[model samples]
Structure formats: structure tokens, C-alpha cells
Target: MGKAIELNQVDTIYEGEKIPSLKNITLHVDKGEFIAVIGPNGAGKTTLLETIMGLLESKRGEVKVLGKQLNGNGSNIRKLVGYVPQEYSIDDLTPFLVSDVVLMGRYGKIGLLKPITKNDKTVAKKMMEYLGISELSNRPIGKLSGGQAQKVMIARSLAKEPEIILMDEPFSNLDFEARREVSEKLTHLHKTKNMTFVIVIHDIASIPKVCNRVIVMDSGKIVADGKKEDILKPELLEMGYKGIAC
Candidate 1:
């Protein structure tokens, strides 16, 4: 498989901060691989995903996505990477419908000033159907539950036709059943769609079930990177998370 993402000694420091959020992190993800980035809070998992998504500027090192550098020439690369944030920050009073939100994903490809076409609407509806959220299409985004909102987010991401999708703590606030359902759907998508996925997750148990490989982070550094069986041992789990047993 071809390399989908590569990071070499990457570092990023937010303004007015003493230490960088990401410190000399080096990693690579191959095409069609499902990698779960596991760590405790403030371990730089989200920073790593944002940096790769071109949402954060790096202070040092190299980040290449789909063979293209992610510094200044990341516009095209960003198009190939779909991002599902941990939480959807929607205005409670905003009147946008679910179908409208899904169609927004195509705005990047459609460009500004041009209205959404009939074909775009058709594609968005199809994506909603694929995600099993077609019934919620006309409902307001703010009215959906966490799990339903998450499904809409997934449909929105899929509408972009991204080859690689990055999810940041996607199952954080969900119930056990919802988390399992979403994970199963994601696993199915990974297999059937040939999509490369890198998800940031705090739960260690979910890693072995959802990801083929797991990368463990601690204090903004990657402490362990290996197959799920190799990295999920008690010793490594203790290194990254406190009061946790494997």
C-alpha cells in the first residue's frame, strides 16, 4: 500500500505557550490502514490531527499528506482529507436543516458564490441514506441527539469523497451501544470503501477492536507505536494513562 500520511519530527507551539503541543512527533500511515491514536487528555492527539489537517501551523519539521507537503501547499491535500471533529459546534438557534449541513461539505469543491446544484443535493441525500440518517435529513441539526448528530457528521464527511478521514475523539460522549454501533459502521466503511482512517481515541479497549495499529502518546510525545496486540499491554497502557488496567 502507498503511504497516505508521513510526519517527521513535527512540532507545533501555540502562542504564549512555553512547550509545544506536539513535540518532535514522527509517524507514517499507509493507505487503507485504520490507525487509532490513543492517549489521555492533553496528550497532543487533537493537535496531531489538526496539524495534519492544515488547521494548525507547525513551528518545525515536515508533514506530508498524499505525497504533498502540508505547509503552504495544503489546500489540495486538505480536500483529500475529511475531518470529523469530536463535537459539532452548531448554533442552537440556527435554522439549518440536516440536509443543508450535509451539502455544505461540497461547498469547498463547488466554490463560493455558486449555489448548490440539483446534483449536489442528490449526492448529499444519497450520503445521508448511506449513513442511515435519511429520516433525519429535514430535521434541524440542533434537535438531534449526540449519536444522531455524529451520524450526520459522518455523512457530511463522506459527502466530500475523501480518501483519508481523520476523526478526533468521535465517540467521547456517546453511550456504550452508540459507540459500538458507530465503530462497527466505521470499520465497515474502512473495509468496503478502501478509506484510510486515523482516529484519536481515549479508550484503550476500543483500539484493539477498531484499529489494526495503535499509536500511544504521552506528554505530547509518541511513546509507543505498533500493532494493537503489541501496544495494548499493561505496561504501555500504564505509561500513557493513569489508574487504568489493560
Candidate 2:
């Protein structure tokens, strides 16, 4: 019922970089909140999410997620948070099957050393159905197209049964129809399960209609945060970005 994530004046720097990738970022996300983070290239959108997940160690200030501090043994906290990265590399001929990839999502909850149980497989298959990819279960993952592969990744994340899901540029590879479908799917999950979502996206057109809050970032700083309608003002396009927000 409290904040799901909190960051206070946090600064994150990449090794060998003169300037921090994230600067003075402060944010609090409530439980069950759906947030859209949109910005032009070079914004710290990715860095901000990474910092909250302890992927980017904070150079200064504090970060707490689900009541756990960012520093020290964050594995337990990570198990509660699902992250779908921007890109993952796999050989075009990789032998891994779609089911295999999705099944790995359960490894966190099932534990690294334990064998997967029947319940785990059931959950993974349900996730596949939710993503409309159940037919691909036996197919080789590398055989799928860009949009199909993205759905597989999302299903994989959901198999973990995470309380909060963080997605980065999830709609980048999808066609317009695919993007809208996936957006609606996310909205359904949020509505039914009260799931918390913070998605980093470039295309404003793809922002799920269910998202009530939006955060805008530029030059490693959060330039604006408020109701989705208020933050997407026309003038926002003039700041940092060159083309349409979508």
C-alpha cells in the first residue's frame, strides 16, 4: 500500500565517463501504479530504471525498492522485480525453444539448483497463452520474427510472477498492430492483478491508454513528472528530441 520504489537525489556514473548517466533523480512509484517514461535519445530513462534495480550502482544518494535498500545482497529483491532488457543476443540457429526461454523465467522463483516443477511449467504455459504465443511453444526461439521474439521475452518475464515489471523499449520492434495489442495486454494484466509497471518507451503512440502517469527525462535529469495528459504537452516535443515523440 506504500511506495513500490523510491529514489532520492540518486546519481549514477558509468565507468570512464566524465559525466554521470543519471543525475539527481528522485522518484517514488506507488503500488499498482502504471507509469510511462518517455524521452528523446540520450535521456537517462534506461539509467534510471537500471539504478532502481541495482543494475547501476548509485554514485550518490539513496535508492530503495519494495522496502529494501539498493546496496548489498539485492538478489531477493530482484526476484520480486522482473526486467525485460532492450536487447538480447541469440544465434540465428540457436537451438533454444520458445518454451525453454520462457521456462527460464521461473528459475528465479524455483531457485537455481531446484528442478522445475509441474506447477512452474503450467505457469509458463499460461503466460504464453496470455501473450498469444502458445503455438510457438515447441518452435525454436530464433525462428520467430522481431515482434514474436519480443512477446516471448515478455512471457518469459511474466513466468517469474514478479510483483513489478520493468520493460525497456518493448514496442520498438513491433508493428503498429502488434504494439497496440501488447499495450492492451499490459493494461489487462494491470487491471486484473494490480501489477505495477514502469515502461521506458520512445513512441508516444504506444503508451498504453491505461497509464495514468508519465515521466519525461532529458540529459540525465527528470524534466517533468505528472499526470499523463499534463506531461505530453506539445512543447515537450521541442525539448531535446528532433522527430515526433512516437
Candidate 3:
């Protein structure tokens, strides 16, 4: 596999904090690989994702994506990447439909002052269909359940046609069946689309089903990196995540 993303000795410090959120973090992701970043709370998982997305500045080291340097702004880099946040906040009473939110994914490519074209609408509709949410396209985003809303978010991300997709705790609020369905859908997409995926997940059990590689972080550092069956051993799980591997 060819390298899709690389971080070398990356470090970041939030305002007014003496300690850095990330310390000397280095990793490389291959193209079309499904990688899971797993860690306990305050382990800098969010910070790492933000750094890759160019939402936060790196105080030290370099981050390269798609063979190009990520200079913090990352506007050009972002064009090839899609992000689905952990939570979706919208007013229940708002009139915006699910399709409307999905269409927003095309805005970055469409540019300002240009109206959404037929091709953009077609793409958004196709993404919705791909996610099995075509029936909910006309529903209000705020009225959807947690799982439904998450599906919409995933659809929106896919509509961007990005080479790399980053998801932050997408199944955190979902029920058991919903979680399984979403995981399977994500796995299917990754395999069929040949896209690189970097997901931040808290559950150890889900990692084996969703990711090919597992990265364990603790105290703002990567403690272990290997295949799921290798790194998810009982001892490593207890030591790094302080939880059962289940």
C-alpha cells in the first residue's frame, strides 16, 4: 500500500496549557487502509483528528497528506478529505430537510456565488441512496433519531467524493443494532470505494469488525500499533485502555 498520510514528531499545545495535547506522535497511513484510533478519554484522539483536518495548528513537526505538506490551513488538502463529527446539532423545529444538509457537502467544491447544479443534486441523492436513507431525504434532519442522524452525516461525508474520510466516534450514541448496521455499512463502503478511513472509536469490540489496523493511545502518545488481533490482546487492552477487550 502507498502512503496516504504521515505525521512526524507532531506536537500541539492548547492555549494556556503548559502540557502538549500531542507529544512526538508519528504514524503513517497507507492508501485505502481502514485504521482505528482507540484510547481513553483525554488521550488526544480528538486533537489528533483536528490536526489532520487542519482545524488546529501544530506547534511542532510535520503532517503530510496525499504526498503534500499540510501547512495548518489545509484548504487544498481538505478538498480530498471528508470529516463526520461525533454529534449533529440541529433544531427539531427547523425546516431544513435531510437532503439540504447533504447538499452542503458540495458547497466546498461548488464555490461561493454558484447555485447548486443538477449534477450536485444527483450526487447527493445517490449518496443518500447508497446509505439506504433515500426514504428519509425529505425528512427534517432535527426530527431524525440519533442513528438516523448519524446516517445522514455519513451520507454527507460520502457526497463529498473524498479520497480519505475521518469519522469521530460515529457510533457513540447508537444502539446495539444501529451500531452493527453502521459498522457494516462503513466496512462495505471502505471495501467497495477503495477509500482510506481513519476513525476514532472508544469501543474495543467494534474495532475488530471495522478496522484492519488498530492504534492504541494513552497519555497523549501511541502505546501500541498493530493488527486488531495483535494489539487487542487482553494485557495490552488492560494496560493501554484500562478496559476489557470485549
Candidate 4:
């Protein structure tokens, strides 16, 4: 198996910002690896994930996914990569159904104007079932709880059958029980489907047990990267989290 993702001496700066949000981010993630990114607020965790997804253009260096460099062809790369942003909100009166929202994931592969296939619908429902949200398929996305909504997003990401998924704060706004459930679901996907996952999480305790590797970012730089056991040590975590138990 080859590398699933690679960042070589990459630097990305947001518009109007003098300092790059990601600095010298040279890293390689192999296929089938489950990686957890943890750090304090403003640690550039989100920035790094966005760069990998090609959502944020890099100021310098190269980001390659699935053996292709992400340049003007980001949309092509996105067809193979599923991404769940860190923040998403639904208006109270929005009429989009849960199934519709999930089916949208297929748009990256099938195109927006093209006809939807039976296989696409089947995949969307199957993903919802896998995430234990099948019963809510017909419900309005705006009506579901935060946890349920997050699950929908995950299902949507899976609906595309992506080779790799990049999720930012997948467990945010959820209670402990919801967090555990989601973590277990992700573990099942990793083991059964061999889908690579790179998740950015703020809660240290929320890091899934299946994630063997952890990458720590601080001040737009990768301060540390190692096994979960080593990087989760308070001394090492303190460098990014300031002993605050992030």
C-alpha cells in the first residue's frame, strides 16, 4: 500500500494574515492509518486538516492525497476524500431531509446536475444504517439534535465511499455517551472498511482508543507526533495544551 496523504514543507496562511497558519508541515500518512490530531485552541489543528483536504490553499509547499498533488485539481482530489468541517449549523426552518443531506455527499462523485442513481441512494441509506441513524432518514436535518446531526455528517462522508476521511471535531456538542457511540462507529469503519481517518479533536479524552497515532500541533507548527501513549503524557501535552487537559 502507498501513502494516503503527504505534506512536504507546507505552509498555509489565511487571507489578510501575515503569519502562516501551518508552518513547515512535512508529514506522511499511510493508507489504513487512524490519526488523531489534538491541541489547544488556535493550535492550528483545523488549519492543518483543511490544508490536507485542499479546502485551504497553501502559501508554499505541496499537499498530495491519494498519490496526486493538490493544486488546481482540488475538486478532483475531493472526489476521493471525504471531509467534515469543524462547524456546521442548520436553520430551524430548513426543509432539507436527513437523507437528502447525506445523498449530497455523492455529488462530489456524481456531479450536481446529473441524475442520482439507485446505487447512490442505497449507499446513503447504508451509511446511515451503519451510523445508527437510519430511522431518522426522513427527518429534517434541522430537527435533529447536535449528536444526531453530527452522525448525519459522518454518514454523508461515508456515502461517497471515500478512501480517506478528514473530520474536524467530530464529537463536538455531544454528550459523553454520544461521543463514545460515535467513536465506536468510527473504529468499526476503520477496521471493517479500511478507511483512513484523520480527526482533529479538542477533548483529549475523546480520542478514540483505536487511534494508535497522535499528532500535536501548536502555533501553526507540528510540535510533536508519536504514539498515543507517548504524546498523551501530560508533559508532552502541556507544550500545546498548557496543562489544561485538552
* lDDT string, candidate 4, 60-146, tens digits: 998999899886847878889998888887997889999999999999778779899999999998889888899999999999998
Candidate 3, residue 169: how far the Cα is off, in Å: 0.8
Name the top lDDT candidate: 4
Q: List the residue pairs that clash in candidate 4.
A: none
Put down candidate 1 lDDT per residue, 5-35, tens digits, no spaces: 9999999888889899999999999999999
* Superposition error at 188 for model 2 (Å): 1.1
Positional deviation of residue 6's Cα in model 2 after best superposition, in angstroms: 0.4
Candidate 2 structure quality by residue, lDDT tens digits, 41-108: 88988888888777778889998888888657566667888888887876789999999999999997
What clash pairs does model 1 have?
none
**TM-score of each predicted structure versus truth:** 0.89, 0.92, 0.89, 0.92
lDDT of 3 at 125: 98
Against the reference, the lDDT scores of all candidates come to 0.82, 0.87, 0.83, 0.88
Candidate 1 ranges with C-alpha deviation above 4 Å: 71-73, 113-115, 208-210, 235-246
Q: Give the poorly placed runs of model 2, Cα more than 4 Å off.
A: 71-73, 235-246
> Which runs of model 3 end up more than 4 angstroms from their true locations?
208-210, 235-246
